[model samples]
Target: MNDFSMLPPAGQNFWFIPMEEVALFRRFLKGKRVVVTNGCFDLFHVGHLTLLNEAKKLGDFLWVGINGDQSVRELKGDNRPFFPAWERAAIVGSLKGIDAVTIFTEKRATRFLSLVKPAVYVKGADYTSQSLDQEEKEVLNSCQALIKFIPLYPDRSTSSTVERIRKGSLMAEQNK
Candidate 1:
């Protein structure tokens, strides 16, 4: 078993814990209300920051889970997750609103949600309780974790940003 408590807090490695260590890390959480959120976080954009900050307001600690590289590819296609899992975790974990970060292998967060059993689970307003995945919902129900939706910032998304960058690059090349 990993003695996460012994790990140095000053290192970026401390925050980038494996999902398996959630139970061990619970020892440090004691009485804190933890809010859980998961995403690819490939681009580290404002929308991601807004969601994380809002989620932190709901609980004492915000634990963000970044999907593994393979999982992101499975859900988002081969070109997705412009960054690797560790890189994505490092970027997301650096945010002030985020307390802990974990890398999970599943496409859905069911297992991670079950292990963390956070006080709250958050998603973008793009998802509703009715629209939530049945398996994920079941895990949340069993764990009694409240599900909240943070309204998405207008016209903000990794895909959209990528498209805009691509268009701008094309225009720049045309001018040359």
Candidate 2:
């Protein structure tokens, strides 16, 4: 396990933990409900924390499936993902309440669902039972996973953060 304290003070809690090592956390989920969620998590923010914490509450273990760096680049484009997958994974893994972290390369976490077989699969409030993409819908419907949608904090997003950075830079240039 990476020593989280070795990271910079600003984001010391975020430490890259390889998903292959998740077996160590298995004891936490033994005979207990497990909840799974996946995302790019390029920018760590309050909304992300809120969602993660909430997911943890629904089950005994919270397993976060983060997109690998290559996967993030493929799904989100090269300009996307301000932070590398390792950094993002580390950050999520370091959270106090999260039980395990893993990397899944697919555009969606269907393979992860098969491996973990979580009792619940969580997404933001934007989706519904019927709104799930065909594969996701099939997975949920076929007893592959249970779907749960948490409320979305509409104003909090990575895109907005990127926009804010751009605006800040532009304003600085104007001031000069």
Over 1-176, each residue of candidate 1 has an lDDT whose tens digit, in order, gives 22334334664533666776888887788799989999899888899989999999999988998898889999899998788887777778767778889988899888888888888999999899999989989989997889999999999988899999999999999999
Question: Model 2 Cα displacement at 161 (Å)?
Answer: 1.1
List the global CA lDDT of all models: 0.85, 0.75
Give per-model TM-scores.
0.89, 0.80
TM-score of 1: 0.89
lDDT string for model 2 (62-170, tens) is: 8888987777888778887777666677789879988777777677766666566678888888667776667756665575566789897778878788889999999
Q: How close is candidate 2 to the true structure, as a TM-score?
A: 0.80
lDDT of 1 at 100: 88
Q: What is the lDDT of residue 21 in candidate 2?
A: 48
- Check candidate 2 and list the clashing pairs: 14-91, 15-90, 16-90
